[model samples]
Target chain A: MPERSLARYPQAVTDWRDFSDDGLTPTLRAARGLFARNGYHATSIRAVAEAAGLSVPGLYHHHRSKQAILGALVDATMDRMLAHTRAAEADSDGTALGRFDNVLECLLRFHMLRRDDAFVASTEMRSMDDTLLLRHIAQRDEQQRMIADIIAQGVADGTFRCGHVDDGARAAASLCVAVAGWYDPTGVLTADEVVARQLDIARRIAGFPPPP
Target chain B: MPERSLARYPQAVTDWRDFSDDGLTPTLRAARGLFARNGYHATSIRAVAEAAGLSVPGLYHHHRSKQAILGALVDATMDRMLAHTRAAEADSDGTALGRFDNVLECLLRFHMLRRDDAFVASTEMRSMDDTLLLRHIAQRDEQQRMIADIIAQGVADGTFRCGHVDDGARAAASLCVAVAGWYDPTGVLTADEVVARQLDIARRIAGFPPPP
Candidate 1:
């Protein structure tokens, strides 16, 4: 919703960039951890500074405000995720369920790999103002609409056996949300491993086969 | 886990009779709203009391502490949910995926219909001390193990296909979590309608018919 602070991040972060690799500095990491553990409303600059092991001014120098830090976190996460999910959508040229699989895989990966970001994006986005909420909602709708289109196409082609596209879409949407509420990092499966299996699960739920 | 306080509730609650209907009074309602919106730690007795129009003394006169309220909320939600899932698990004469469907349908209904309780049960449970966490983890394992048994049974009978029962169980666990994040009351489907459609999806995902 809000524009990315090109100042905070070095030059452009292309699809090649992985936030876990080098994009996140100590300050950003602390902000993310605090926000994830304690919510945005409850978190304070002092705590973020404390987590980062920096003075108040030091933390403030990197970001404008706590809310801006939240916005930056959202933007950074969404930017990389947008890159990944867009790629998934690009592969959606097959059956309706095929496109659905592509998107579902991306959604699962986004939550698994970026759990904190996923929390910040979905829950903390409510802290955004009206204009930002509209823009963020638009991006979210774009993603949802893409999957909805796939389900609709499946119904039209008779590939997906379901009551209706809307019902299918709701089921699909609900499935993605569950990832955020339940993903455990220290648990059995690695994020990538879970994504591989969940992609297939998502496809079958959509009444389609796994990708060839 | 903290012993659930019947004291936080009124005489009806104290008698442990008609507690199901009348026990969910202003006190529990406040706890539900606070825990859902703010999570466990951030939710305070003062806030809950104010929201419920009860003074701090009055609130404390009921549940001695905030954490106790959370414990009670999680316990009630899980108690009902595990009962339904347990009932669903016992009736496993069909395909492995069919049993999974029954359990999944019950979970989605529990989550969507009782959203606040779901949130408190899943996320806020973490706010409990280590001892409570262990007990809660034990309860979660029981549910997951039940699911794994169904998958193992399906595999043995050649009714379901998966790389591993563990994988299926994990996917099933993740599937249940996704429901809490996105379910909306005013959405197209009623809670019953959503659960029915989700059951269809869960069956397909669990390899209900099993691949030839």
Candidate 2:
């Protein structure tokens, strides 16, 4: 087993927090809540305006179309996620196992804390056009590949022992992403507990014991 | 690690295959495809009827309403999944770890092979009314508890290691459920490979190695 680190990944816009309360923030937040609750296709612009307490024209003033809102949400989610992961990678300086734990912690914590954002981004990804979908997919792939790289490095240096590094990486990433699908902020497990448990599962997949 | 066995669980009409060409099979199949592709709310009863090549009334002859279709899909998925798991438990004869692996395999295979059903059941579960939603949640909890029981038994006998058995079980079940979200029939990894990889991950989370 290797020692795990508590160093935080450089945080990006915390689930779109940097958006000023201006033309689009309220509208986008309403859209995210609506899309997270109702299926995206079933949610109309009128519904979004109603949720945001904006008149139709006012909402239209910000977002040209409903698809624009969906596109923006999906694009921002991928961008923020990838930025956090890249920052984690850049800031990490330790053994491969330590780096792997650091990156996994960052990814799990982001998904756990931003459940609604994650839910809407994941469930509504199909609503995006092919071009936007491809772009988002590329960003997602980069995040997964970064984890894979860390696993490969760990295997190379004899810090991890897994049968297939690529498969292990994919499973670990999938397990982390799945947390967004079912994590309940109101549930028994606190956000911190969910993050800790998921990191434990990641270590198990990496064929290592939890760092003492 | 407790030894895993090769005993087979009893099967239950694998994913609606035994349905005769009758009032509900075609309609349910069409509904699954539509619900999986276009989503539940966006897919209308007329669309399902058209997909099944039946008139609206004819479709209603079997399913009274769209909500009925959604409920039936969700309930049947839970029933089938629970049935498979219970049967696995009944048929298995080995250490707690062996039964755990057996149950996990049934679950992972069900989610992988019945991706469309799993998709609709998971994503459209919210479409069900309060009664149906509660019913389905109970069934889902039963499945989770079964896994937890196996983990508890393993822990009592010194066959598995985890910080929390309940959390381990939830994460393991979640990881299995997520297979439906991304498993591609034409992808590079065969279904067997995916199953093998997931089983390995499950074992790791159970604090054990792949059975050899």
Candidate 3:
């Protein structure tokens, strides 16, 4: 991990001086806001710097380029999401269908919280070089695959009625990508509520049991 | 609507001339290729015109601006998709679930045929103004609402089971958005095969019976 990441560079902007994770929340938050609204292709280092109330050069000191900041944002986000999936799984106790619901719920909540970054990650993978793309896709695919594995286990145990593992994989991936386009944190449904609702939908798609 | 839009426009340097739809199957086809490969924002009118084997002014006589071409292309494609949805509704047998399967099949085939336009439409709508945005979303939401209504109808009839209508609506929208990301027409699956598989998957999500 780059030490100068947004996690480490928040104060670099707000105070017009260098600061790290303990001080960089404002900078990280601002960068996320800009990247979500304008798209990375349309955003520049100067814009993020100004938005956070820092000089362009000030931003440069914390991160080498606009892409570095982007990478840091994405990497940090991916870690948080994957960890959420694990926690959700650990916390839930039920049949395969119940576990499945919990997983989708976890994804929906994470997706809502990181909605803009979710959109950025889904759309901008093309901008990354092969190594970066490979790394990101692996992380992304692993999340889907974990869900797919659960579905596959369900299918094997006769808990769900999927025709193929690939179908489950496809559904899991589609569900995640779908979240980026229309999800709004301010919408009537709380992220917690949404997770439950999406889990219900995911279960139905996976041919699992409806909640009792 | 722009009489002769950018689709038929040749590059500012090319020998192709005029932007009219009259000899246009080849030109529009080329424009789709470029838009798919380079994305709508990065692509220039000159590049589009050149790709079509026409000159810049030749391209311009047809399209007043880059957006005119994009709008016309979207309009043309949306009409086709709407037609496909209607046809799917008409062609399917049995209950609303049957109709939904047809819609899903149509969706898979529609995206396969117009994957480039689908990619463009899903990602480029934010760039359009209110007038175009309204038109696009109206058409898109119309189809989504239709599917949601069918799912809701299925739930009412006990053919499908889900807790909420809004969740069904979200699911339908999410399913469509997912198509833009991972579809590859020339890959292992033929277009029809993909439609068949996706229809099965859609049926499961809607909580309807899979095809016999």
Candidate closest to the true structure, highest TM-score: 2
Please tell me which predicted candidate would have the highest DockQ against the true structure.
Answer: 2
lDDT score, candidate 1, position B74: 61
By DockQ, the candidates rank as 2, 1, 3
Indicate the residue-level lDDT of A46 in model 3.
Answer: 80
Query: What's the C-alpha lDDT at position A76 in model 2?
Result: 60
The C-alpha stretches of model 1 lying farther than 4 A from their native spots are: A1-4, A7-19, A22-28, A49-65, A88-105, A125-129, A150-192, A210-212, B1-26, B52-64, B88-101
For model 1 the local lDDT of residue B19 reads 16
- What digit string (tens of lDDT, one per residue) describes model 2 on residues B1-212? 01001011134544332212212256777888888776787889999999989899887777778988777667666767777777777667868877988889889888887877777877776677888888878878899999999988888887788768887898889878878777888999887788888888888887774222
lDDT of 3 at A167: 63
State, as a TM-score between 0 and 1, how close model 2 is to the true structure. 0.84
Query: Per-residue alpha-carbon lDDT of model 1 for A1-212, expressed as tens digits?
Result: 12235413445334421335424667677788877777776788899889989899977787778877776676666666666666776766776666676778777766666777677677665467676667677767766777778877876787765555554565565556667667788888887776677666666666664222
Give the clash total for candidate 3. Answer: 14
Q: Please, what is the TM-score per model?
A: 0.77, 0.84, 0.80
Scored by lDDT, model 3 comes in at: 0.66
